[model samples]
Target: MASTDSHSCVVYLVDPQDGKKGTVVPDRFRRLAIADGCGVVGLESADEDGGSQEELTGLIVAAIAAVMERQDPAELGGDGRAKVGAVAKQAGFKVTKVQFDEAWPKYVDGLGADDEDKDGE
Candidate 1:
């Protein structure tokens, strides 16, 4: 589910705790700090995109779908969780993993994956 939505903008999301110690940041715009996805790779991920971008764009798509559905991608089951862990190492998300058989689904198990699950995987 690569999005060719030409109408787009990058938004930087910062955890409040990561702010300068005691510094006050006025509520501002929201942004995505990702690159190598769909179209337009941000400068942030430019240096890191040295041939390791497999499924990175799909990861972004899945993540967006999860948020839209109010589902936490990390807590998803089967294929969803498998895909999440696959990109965790590269995407820099500190998540735990189980065995391979457990990580992936037994079959193609389409449908749910049509919502970007398999593509993301």
Candidate 2:
């Protein structure tokens, strides 16, 4: 999992290999930050080495769609998590954990002010 703006925005990427995880984020999967609100937008790409990047991408997209189509917003979170898990299971790729806090500390600090406020109270 990768977080930006102090963990307000996070992105998760699952590798279609051994499932090893890393959290330094790139611009590609930035849309995942919206997962809690409007749902996440996922994009997947695979190399020609029998990797299931395409499949995984499709699964993520489908998951997002499934979550968005839910009648209640409260259900979106659970549905999204389920969809992500499904994609990982169906695709032969391992998921990479990326975090913006480690990648962009300044950004995270700035974004996390709200968290600080909540914690302070």
**Candidate No. with top lDDT:** 2
TM-score of each: 0.20, 0.25
Candidate 1: the clashing residue pairs are: 11-30, 11-31, 11-32, 12-31
RMSD of each: 15.0, 16.7
User: What does candidate 2's lDDT look like per residue over 46-93, in tens digits?
Assistant: 434223333334444444434434534444345233233333333223
Worst 10 residues of 2 by lDDT: 95-104
Clashes of each: 4, 18
Candidate 2 global TM-score: 0.25
Model 1 local distance difference test score:
0.36
Tens-digit per-residue lDDT, 1-121, candidate 1: 1223334443323335665322222222111222322222333454545322323334444443443355555545654543444434333332234322322332223336575865786
- Judged by whole-model lDDT over C-alpha atoms, candidate 2 comes out at 0.38
- Report the number of backbone clashes for model 2: 18
Candidate 1: regions farther than 4 A off: 1-51, 71-121
